[model samples]
Target: MIKCCNYDRKYPMAWDREDFSRAYRRLAPVYDHGLLLYELVGMRLRRYRREAVAGLHLQPGDTVVDLGCGTGVNLPLLLGAVGPTGRIIGVDLSPEMLEQAQRKIDAEDWCNVELVASDMVDYVFPPHVDAVLATLALATIPDYDSVIRTIASALPPGGRLANFEMTWPEAWPDWLVKLGAKLQQPFGVTTDLKDRKPARSIQRHFARCDSSERYFGAISFCIAIRQAGTGVNV
Candidate 1:
């Protein structure tokens, strides 16, 4: 059965972390199944994940953080990239989501995976993290610019950040973009979809930023590397 929590408020103009936590608390169990349907329907969202992660170009023994790592779907790829000696810290706002992710770690006997339950804004990132990744998660963060700034500060110079998020292409009709936003509302996506360009925000903090759009311009992926001598004031 598909279970979901109550969200009586109107769709938010930006990320309401509390509401998203509540919604995902119930949605966690069936989240993977829902993604399967999304993929079958031609979204092929997992491809975006794979592409973004590959861009990180991770090495064995490196430590990586999977920001907003819902249900640990990227753990396998991360573990593969980093090898058994590497570590992965998966952070999410929902405890239920982390619970599911923990199960995946246990099932795979991955001794290096760590799951933390906290909002991205307040979470304490560890030092020496080689890369950070967020897939289909940044758009849900109301203060994504702040979050990007935090990530930039936490990483060492040349550290990588990869993100895959929703986007509305200029070529797409107004009606289609509206329809896309409407379809995403049930999943706690921000109502202001047109204004959430995560790639641009990421570029402000990084020296090198590479971005691409996929799924007919409905999705955008960005990989940025922190530059030397830049520090976040916050």
Candidate 2:
């Protein structure tokens, strides 16, 4: 029998790091299949991933970091943009998720991609990354603000950051929003939808921020550019 992870009990306002890691461990094996509805039911989350990566405007031989990169869904896109000469550092908390990502790298014979199993909050940022991309993963991070600040500090001037994650829509009725949050609960999303606002946090760290909302405003894709002389010098 397949074991299911339970997260129904009360968690902190933000997810505990260990708790989040355990949750993704149980979900990793079937995680990609679980997202089929979003891909096939007109939601097309992959489109947002593509758009976000495109905003990076990467060149051959550039290095990029894929923060919270689950199952390497964003790898193919990143690989296409950076080419063989570039490097991709895919980071996640779950070893299981990173295992799945490793399989993809092996299958594609991609020598440039590296998988790092580490929490986003504590993971060391490599110097001079051309871009950082995270999709559908930021909302699950408990200390997302601090992570953004760290990214801002590590990136070179003019490095790009792109994030895509769930959002609570203002126009949606409270009942509908509640229902949506409930639907997403099993996937380890915070019960309170408002905590998923990465765009607002991104704006604070980045000088040029561009955002696009989709999926009835329940999803947001943001691309922000780190301006010269912004944040602490790393």
Candidate 3:
């Protein structure tokens, strides 16, 4: 049941097959240690948060949701950007990750973040959100269509969704990106989804979308805006 579009075993909050549950369960204990390398290298976490906020043009009162918001690396940056008037929601599938996220939120004394444990593919969202951002998380969900629809449905017309994911860049040499991604696959990160299916799916569901690639094609982001005049009454 666990096959990468390419990669698992089961535990609490595992959203996919039995393998995923087991893999995530094993990962939970050392996930932070494994991720520390990324944090140290090029300050990837900080950069992703910076890029996510900049892409969204976030405002003081806007509401934002971070799907698959593991350990809440982006929450502090987001809280600063949105300020006291705005709200932030962090949704994740792992209870252990959410515990880490809550610790980060408390350490920063942020009062506006609400972290929920849920699967990104089928989670129900509030009626309106100004923006949705997920970093290094979207490529994990193979059911891209349902995930995109859920994100789209959560936004009001004119709202935005910006996602930063590991992707292989079409413009760059593919071999290098693939090799780097392969090295990282064991830690629950991969670039296979970023190729065409994820990109095409976004364009099909959204009126306008764009992306920026960084880190020698190791990181990429997609930004989409809901049409303001859709008349769907978000």
lDDT by residue (61-171, candidate 1, tens digit) is 999999999899999999989999999999999999899999998887999999988889898888799999999888777688989888988899888999988777768
Ranked by lDDT from best down, the candidates are: 1, 2, 3
Model 2 agreement with the true structure over 61-122: per-residue lDDT tens digits: 99999999989999999999999999999999889999999999999999999999888989
Scored against the true structure, residue 119 in model 1 reaches a CA lDDT of: 89
What candidate 3 gets wrong by more than 4 Å, as runs, is 1-18, 29-33, 39-45, 170-182, 190-196, 230-234
Clashing pairs in 2: none
Worst ten in a row by lDDT for model 3? 5-14
Per-model TM-score on C-alpha atoms: 0.90, 0.90, 0.80
Local accuracy of candidate 3 as per-residue lDDT tens digits, 10-109: 1112134344444565666677787778877774756667877788878998899998888787887788778899999998887777888888788878
Point out where model 2 deviates above 4 Å: 1-12, 229-234
- Candidate 2 lowest-lDDT run of ten: 2-11
Model 1 C-alpha lDDT versus the unseen true structure: 0.82
Taken over the whole model, the C-alpha lDDT of each candidate is 0.82, 0.81, 0.71
